[model samples]
Target: MSPRIGYFLSCEEYSPSQLIEQAKLAERAGFEALWISDHFHPWNDAQGNSAYVWGMIGAISQACSLPITTAVTCPILRQHPAIVAQAAATAKVLTNGRFTLGIGTGEALNEHVLGQRWPNTDVRLSMLGEAVDVMRQLWTGESVTHHGDHYTVEDARIYTLPDEPVKVYVSAFGPKALEVAARIGDGLCSTMPEADVVSSFKEKAGPGKPAQVGYKVSYSTDPERALDYAHELWFNEGIPGEAAQVLSSPKHFEQLAPLVTRDAVAGSTVHEADVDKHVAEFAKYADAGYDEVFIADMGPEYEGFFRFYEKDVLPRIRG
Candidate 1:
């Protein structure tokens, strides 16, 4: 089957109104879905924007018909699972069943804001597992009381659930968490174009489940400006392993970013002026078995990127 093309709404860099405008543009440009980042803080101070994701999502529901998914939210930290379940249920009702709750173990950058000690990855994964279970129970439209190792819910129910079950997609970057996603999640959310992860998820989740991947690239008429913009905004993207997960703030991330080599950050993304090159980069993920591929243009201008994509990139890949 041909893969679905989607636009990623970068909430860290755009205001709520801009996000809604981009959502409308993306739908008009023939993208099939929308992925919005749910974050309490921007990765770097230079990015300069962090709108509340839930409020922005409500605006998106009214502005566009495209299906929406949080690129990944952490219900395990900063918010209780019961609250996450309630908010997700309302989103599903508002979007008329077009919402998917994409969740993850979370990063210290966002989760540490509440002044809680950041737990290690293993504990976070355990919390995420229990959280997903709690959410699923509440989505059944029955009052639920859950007391797990990480969280507790007493007499909580989601009255606003849609007729269809709200799909839950789990994001993972490693084997252990991938296993958790397979065991509990309805779909998989990831960033890498690694086929092995997709293969493993499909094998473990059995058949007929979907996996989605989001990738970043910079598109501009000026190749040099594109590369510079990508480096300035996402140099920290090259931070290896779970380092990005543990860093507590954008200042910490900024300090570590300069150590990342240009090639390293450029390797993490496609920073080319050519539309065909951008299209090819996306095809790599689709060929890797991602059911949906969401692309974020790291260039400062969204409208130009959207126009270039609608005129060139979408047709080649969506075909």
Candidate 2:
């Protein structure tokens, strides 16, 4: 099948209503699907909003017919796997079996908000494995009592399940997490356009499993202004290594944001006026073997970005 192109809704920057509206706009624009960030908190002070994702999914289900996927949610700490299973099941039914549960080991920003200590990557992966097991077992619609190393589910059953099982996509940026995703995930979700990651996933998960990727673009007629917005709102993205995953809160990110140069953010995100440049950036991900490429607008405004992509970008990429 040809790769699908979708919109990446940044919940941290848009209200739930706005996100649903954007989903409708995306569908009207002929986009194939929607990917929403599942964050409890905004990355920094400038990008100011983080709506409850599950609630937004319910709204999006009513607003549009596009399939939905969480860019990545942590189902281990902030929520248990059993609860996630129920939520996914409900989401699937609401969207008419068009929902995909994209999950990850999680970041400190979202998972640590409940005052829980953030474990290292290795430990989190272990926890994620157990959590996936719990969620999958519960999805069987049987009374599942799972007492695993990281989670315990007592006589749990999800009654409101869809006809087909909700697809579970696991997010990964590193080696260990990649292995876990390949072994247990229904598909793969990632933010970077790394072909090696795809190679690794397909190598282990077999060649036919889906790999979905997300990329950020600060699309504006004015490239310089777009670059400035990207720097302000997503400079935290340029934080190298596991810092983006390990930082406990937005303040911690803010403390390091100044050190991130505008060029760094510009380099990380596609801050461009040229529609061709945006199309090429997306092509890289699709060419890298991603089954789906979800592009997020990093600029403050969405109308221009949406319009430009709808008119100029999507068609070229879809072709």
Candidate 3:
């Protein structure tokens, strides 16, 4: 197999029943896994989102029969790793071993709200490494009292932990984080499947570890509409600078926020051009040896989008 194919769902916006419907359609359409997003808010301006993730996950478990994981979540700053561990344990029991904990250092937008300190880039990565260490220890179904540099625990045990350790997939962007992932992670998770980054990560990240990538784009009947939506959300995702680096800094996003104006996000997508364009975009990641690719779209035309993909993209790409 050339690696699994997957998609993202917006549990926040969709009603519980609506989420079930789409998840069933996605699984039946042959997507191997479902990677969903977790957010306390939906960007700025309230975007009309921000649903409860735990409840949504519970509903998803009952409604669909496919593997699932958070594309990436920050368990450290906002929520205690203990809570995350408990939730993951319950979800694992519910899903029968179909969930993986995809974790990251976290962004300030979600982490800073609790009045907890949000460290700089390097420090945040350090906290993440410690958090993972702590989470794994707690998940062992043993009483743990970890006293680490960033996090500490006392006589903690999770009897509900699944029979085995939950695979911890670390999300990294640059060199340092990748090294952390290599040191502790069972798998690699990133949104950018850039070949050089993957190669660099694998090089320093060590051997025998698999790499996974996730990316997003919009779908529309008109090329311009698609590009517009894409740019609105993504131009910053590609905004030619250390955005590649400074995601840890809340100010970086605020500074770059102006560039991904309504126009930029809207005008940068490539829908209605060619299905090959979408396939080729994803194929580049597959070509880079990503063990899996999870893609999401942000428009209402996903039914039509998947129809086009199934008829035109999946046959050729899945081969």
TM-scores across all candidates?
Answer: 0.97, 0.97, 0.88
Spell out the clash pairs found in candidate 2. Answer: none
C-alpha lDDT (0 to 100) for residue 319 of candidate 3? 67
What is the Cα-based lDDT of residue 266 in candidate 3? 46
Write down the worst ten-residue block by lDDT for model 3. Answer: 242-251
TM-score of model 3 vs. true structure: 0.88
Q: Name the lDDT of candidate 3.
A: 0.73
In order, what lDDT does every prediction score?
0.88, 0.88, 0.73
Candidate 1, residue 295: Cα displacement in angstroms equals 0.5
On TM-score, the stronger of 1 and 3 is 1
Total clashing pairs in model 3: 11
- In model 1, the runs with Cα more than 4 Å from the true position are none
TM-score of predicted structure 1: 0.97
Runs with alpha carbons beyond 4 Å of true place in candidate 3: 11-18, 205-207, 232-258, 261-268
Q: Output the number of the lDDT-best candidate.
A: 1
User: For residue 129, what is the lDDT in candidate 3?
Assistant: 80
Mind giving the per-residue lDDT tens digits that candidate 2 earns over 1-319?
A: 5689899999998877789888988898888999999998899988899999999999899989999999888998998888889999999999999999999988898998788889988899999889888888888899998877888778988999999888889998778889999999989999888999998898999866899998888877888998988898888878888888888889999999879998777777788779778877887898888889898888666888888888888788767
